[model samples]
Target: MTTGSTYTLQEINALSHDDFVQALSPLFEGPPWIVAETWSSRPFRSLDYLHASLCAVMYAAPLEQQVALIRSHPDLVGRAALAGTLSPSSTHEQSAAGLDRLSDEEIAAFSRYNQAYRERFGFPFVICARENKKESILAGFEQRLHNSPGQEIMLALGEVAKICLLRLRDLIRS
Candidate 1:
């Protein structure tokens, strides 16, 4: 779909399931199944309503669904497909502060952290790339990995909300 004008509430609501899912593709780079539940409804009255409702639903989602959502986030250090679709400021933040641009020693440390995190959580480490710096992201990865499954799941959901909020704001602004 064209990424030109901001979609009206009506226009957004009228989108087909596939289109609606496509519209949200930039938010999390996971399987369409991760978003299928959200797309099951439509007719949002406004962007705020949509965002709020989505946040509620996401927070209330089952653990399996939450895991899917968390795993959907793009890798912190890689050729992320959604990188270009993110808001320019967010993209700039990632470029200026991402682990991908870290020094050799930092990259090595991140790799170890990434492996340990995945081993602990059984999923990729997640962070709200917009407001985080490399150091903070790494710290979060380390801290969150120490959480119990229940705690880590909740933390991941919160990060998902932050990510969705950023994407929703960008969608309306675009």
Candidate 2:
């Protein structure tokens, strides 16, 4: 996708499958396979349709694939964020949620929570950072850590869908 550029629905609808995948690859943290697989469902009727199609691909995948997708996400305020290795969308989302301005104690708390969550769930805690402030995110970690593995996976996947929807809105005009 072009940096700082937005696409009209008409333009998006007219793109080739390869081009569509390229445009949407950044919607998820890991592989672009979700968008790649969803490409066949286009031309989307609306922005919502496009997002639903992408989420459908994600949700319809086997449990192993779904877990892999969750594994692909980086922890909040974890090593990747501290090291400046996060993807552009991730960086922006985290920054918007005030994650970039955390105090040392706050960072350590996040690190601890992230470690605990991963130890319990075997995947990074996923949330729509663009939709939560630092406080809420920490609270989410606390509350969600108590969830059963099955519950947590579905919750994380729903968060992934929220993240993807926001990213799609940022990229495509309805």
Candidate 3:
């Protein structure tokens, strides 16, 4: 995410819709519209309320929209991670999980699972990698493979929400 000033809720509320979206869209992975929608209900009482409202918009989204939102996320140790092209937040999360230190065999395993997950689910495998280790993430990939499409979609969205919460917490603290 791009660094900028810490914003008061009032300051957030005062921005134009485009400006607000520009400021906060990094918290989510897609176009700025969702955050733009959340902007209308502004003057948030707390950071929690702001995050909740942003999620409210996501929760109300249709199934396809939700899927698109999930698809916006990068795969764990996929091309973006390998090439150092991941967003700052994503790079940090993956590094926190020690993905940046993977051995060759580990990278091979991760790539295999990533491709399989994409084949089955039509999107990257999403997880809140900030607090996870490589083993848990690999285990998650194997376990989640058996889930039905609807379940996987919800699970991915939940992971995405976790990512958003961490981002929000950081932003507010900054």
TM-score top scorer = 2
Query: Which ten residues in a row are the worst by lDDT in model 3?
Result: 1-10
Of the candidates numbered 2 and 3, which has the greater TM-score value? 2
Sorted on TM-score, best first, the list reads 2, 3, 1
The candidate maximizing lDDT is 2
Instruction: Residues 1-174, candidate 1: write the lDDT tens digits.
Output: 124446667777888888887776555546655455577667777777787777777778787887887776655664352345544434554665664467878767777887888788888776777768888988898778779988888887777777777767767642
Error of 1 at 16 (Å): 3.2
Number of colliding residue pairs in each model:
0, 0, 0
**Candidate 3 positional error at 69, Å:** 0.8
- Candidate 1's C-alpha runs over 4 A off are 1-5, 78-93
- Tens digits of per-residue lDDT, candidate 2, 1-174, equal 225668998888888988888888898978888988998887888999888999999999999999999999988998999999988888889999999999999999999999999999899999999899999999999999889999999999999999998888889875
lDDT (tens digit, per residue) of candidate 3 on 1-174? 335556776777788988888888889887776888898988888888998898889989999899999899999999999999998889989999999999999999999999999999899999999969999999999999999889999999889888898888776652
Q: What is the lDDT of candidate 3?
A: 0.88
Q: Which of 1 and 3 is ahead in lDDT?
A: 3
Checking candidate 2 for backbone clashes, the offending pairs are: none
